[model samples]
Target: MSGTFQDRIPVLLVEIMRKFPEERSESEVLLVHNMLSSVSMFRRYSGTLQLLLARVVRYQRLERRRVVIKKGHWGHSFYFVFSGLLAVTKDNDGSSAFVDKEPILIKKGMSFGDVALIKTLRRNATVVCMEETELMVVDKEDFFANKMDVELKREFDYRFSFFRSLQLVSSWSYSLIEQMADHSKAEQFRYGHVVVKDTNDMGNIIFIGKGQCDVLRVVDLTSCSAYQRLLKQYADSVSRGTCLPTHGFKSELTNQPGSVIKHKVLLNNPPRPPRGLLADLPTSACFLIDTLHQSSTFGLNQYLMPSKQRDCRRFTLVSQSMEIMRVEKTRFDKLVDNTTMKKLEALQKTYPSDDELCTVFLEHSRWKDYKHSVVQDLFPHRVAPIRSPKTQKQQGHCGPSQVLQQTRHVVNRLKQTKQRVEPKDNKIKK
Candidate 1:
């Protein structure tokens, strides 16, 4: 089946190219193919069916804030994001989708309008282009012609079931849970991959549907009490002349004819001690603060906390072969009522302040530089010497040509002395 599918891809791609009005590179077509593969609606289909779907999918470009589908309108097409962002809103009116309520952002590799197309019902929600978006569109006629809608209902059902099992959304109404499932996209991450970065501004809430993840914090170890003791030990080593070696002046002498020349290279500046001397002391490190398992949700604190307080601490979520259901924070905030928001806020976890850690790192760096300066001042001998070009020239430095000339003159004198000694020895033998 796989080999047959592989063999058909080239022929299918040629058909896809004909569907597009403008020329598309092989890479661009392949990108569209990958995007189609990522869509949840297409995942259940066989490779051959997916390739067939690819042939019928047409390219579309929509400007920012354009409404692709409105609530209560007959669904005519299904969309897969080729590039750019889109928003799905519950609002019937197009204007309110972006103004009154925050809409769920649909990013690249995601699809929309499948629910309405599959059920053959009017679009219950509105979808608008958030930016200049490039989409691969499948018309209702083509969508159903291939029987692509068959497993779409089942996919949604599975998502709805998954949401129902979560205690976090247990208080939510059935309609709300269903809506959440519709907007949420399942994403996978490899083990040890960063699912969410420290203090991410995007503020997308992630629910761990399967596997595990770790919550990590970057810590500045200079603030620790143990570091203070180590700093004292370093200071003692510096004072006792054991921390670094002393710098020495280099001198070279050259004798030619009646004159003796001396090249005195002075040690002007000393080399700074290696930072690795404090290798035992870590300036910064990452600490595993907590681990999240199945059904655990994160990225809520940013929504609950005030802007000033939101990013005070740095928290990163790293995945361990995890599958996650992610929803935009703005959409989440719009979905829940004031009471639910309060409940979520109450469950917000606090972490150590990143500001304090930054301050500790800065203070330690300054102290390190200050300690180096003090060592140079008190124990001047330990500092390495620097040779200045201007000083060398002023001290009658020997040029390469002059040195070669002097060497030749010395060789000739030795040869003349040898010749005179040889003739005297010959006379003695006679």
Candidate 2:
């Protein structure tokens, strides 16, 4: 096993080399040049993937202790800090100064206090990173593009995977990963094409599907695999710094344009959300199953507020024949009356904001402009990760009081709606 793992690395390397035809070095890919030509908004914002927004909002750079977002203040937008550092702080102690008393740090690309956007919720914590931080503010409008493209899909997918991995997936068995490449479509890159980059929303979920992406510093070739291995190994060992390398396991995360990143798939499923409501749900939302039909307080609580991501959608789907149903929200209402919708209100509260994750929304936006006719054909069945029922154990997620509260609300609402719709029988008297 150990020998095969080591041998696999080198074999992957040669594949990228043979695959990259035009250039000997990574520098020649003309990433920035090509990007500038490829996108109109690339020049406007230093960061890539800036153009797809249906709109844009600007905010001044924070110098020293600027109040980008106040703890307890509603988070109306997300800031993309282009330059400098911004410290994130919270008013945890109920002190006068939310900043001076207890401040948290927020670095570039890392968002803060986003949970406060919904239902006029107060910012849970205060955040700060550094000074002179230039930020691209994503207001409610720009953040919630009705359409999603490959870019937004990839971003939401990465974030969804990131948070999900933090929970049940870490302990997942290697055998359980269902050879991801089996379903994925393969993409071979020329020396000039980039496979991945920092903040890229290309929707590329690569795995060591087949060949290794022999990576170098654009300055050297023998350094091939050296940079990839070094960064990856460093990420594995480091206590803090960049995001964990696992989210986009097969792709590189960097900002330099033209820096060649290559990918094949271990398991690839192009995203296909139904052309209706559930498909437009914000990225932060997830499903919790009360599959057993048990009225147990614990079971009910667990499904009440799914505060974290989970592997399965509450129900343990065994048979493959139970087809996926993609109904429009209206169609859903028509199929199941108000009795069936009692649980949804509880689920919807967790994701208080209507704002879809910026990445997910962005991907939808880009998908509209795609020229490939086959692209629209993708995303029929999504084999989301399923936790093994035998080995899996319920963690008892929600509080008893919360469960009671939600249960009462659902039961009451269902009763009221049923009563209001009841028809009177006047014809019998006539």
Best by TM-score: 1
Q: lDDT, candidate 1, residue 129?
A: 80
Candidate 1 residue-wise lDDT, 1-430, digit = tens? 1113332224444455456433555565565567577555454344555665665688676888888999999878888775677877877656665675556678766678876776678988888887777677878887667666664555567678998997667788999998888776566777756676654554578888889876655444455554455566667887886662211101112222111122111111222223645432334434344567888777764466667865566556667678888776777777788667666865565543444333333343344456657887999888467779896664464432233333333323323343432233221100
Instruction: Name the best candidate (by lDDT).
Output: 1
lDDT of each: 0.58, 0.31
* Candidate 2 residue lDDT tens string, 296-365: 1111222334547421221111111111111122322233334334543443211111111222222322
Question: Which clashing pairs does model 1 show?
Answer: 269-384, 270-383, 270-384, 271-384
- Candidate 2 shows a clash count of 42
Write down the worst ten-residue block by lDDT for model 2: 316-325
lDDT of 2 at 12: 28
| Segments in model 2 whose C-alpha atoms lie over 4 Å from true places | 1-50, 92-122, 145-212, 215-430
How does candidate 2 fare on TM-score? Answer: 0.27
lDDT of 2: 0.31
